[model samples]
Target: MTTGVTGRLGGIARHARPRGPIETLAEVSVSVESGLASDFRGAVKPGGRGRRQVSLIEAGDWAAAMAETGHSLPWWHRRANLLVEGLDLPKTPGTRLRIGQVVLEITQECDPCSRMEEVAEGLKAALTPDWRGGALARVIAGGVIAVGDTIEIIEG
Candidate 1:
């Protein structure tokens, strides 16, 4: 039923390692082995198999959360890897999406953490409902993705 649905890529960001400064980029390289090469989350640790390879959030959801929290923090403050627009991010896990040449599967929600409140009061609560915190995904196929790239749900 989701066939043909599409969205636009709005932004991309990554951190070198845990709790490191986040850097926004115009484009990024993604792979099945490593989610985003520049992102520390991509590194496959001994037990980390890359299931949470990438993180994504919808612009609409972010705006709504900001409105509710009375804060206008940058999308990256949510600490997701990609910002998307237009497409409805599935609430159910296992949804697959294609961005440029990269294929990603939604593994779970990017659950809001105490880190959110550390950024702004009530932010965690604002991002709590309706998948607002974003989606966590694993790279199924490697490809280069740039800002403004088209994103689509891939139906099997």
Candidate 2:
């Protein structure tokens, strides 16, 4: 059942640096409607209530990088379970992803906020304008997602 985007089980090795090709097929557990969900509340335009929700990045290093800067909150604040190596979640806004049986549509970039500043020192300054990290998506189809599940780019 392995395809270009979907594959079998994979291991996730922690990286000392935030940006780099770390590993492939690293499993990221996804949970619905969390802190990321709350942050997403402000990102959506008015009358876009159903368009906001946050899913956890499985092996995210963005949170890890923030931790290195002495931000403990950001370290534990990862809504994503796995931080993938090659995929840029934020860059693919409007794309569709299929993880296990769940289907998600990337809506917008998940920008860092003042709350991130409280977690990692100067994170607000770093993430401003460019928003160089993860993103927010809405679940079009709900299903259980776990580690080792396959992620497929159904539409781009």
Best by lDDT: 1
Residue-level lDDT for 127 in candidate 2: 50
Which residue pairs clash in candidate 1? none
Q: Could you give candidate 2's per-residue lDDT for residues 18-66 as a string of tens digits?
A: 3322332233333344312223232335456434464334234464455
Task: Name the lDDT value of residue 86 in candidate 1.
Answer: 91
For candidate 1, lDDT tens digit of each residue in 17-135?
Answer: 88999999999999888789779887666777677889999999999999998999899998899999998887777788999999988888888999999999999999998788999
Q: State how far residue 11 of model 2 sits from its true place (Å).
A: 12
TM-score of each: 0.95, 0.57
Candidate 2 lDDT score at position 77: 43
Question: Which regions of candidate 1 are displaced past 4 Å?
Answer: none
Query: Global lDDT of each model?
Result: 0.89, 0.48
How many clashes (backbone N, Cα, C below 3 Å) per candidate? 0, 14
Would you give me the overall lDDT of model 1? 0.89
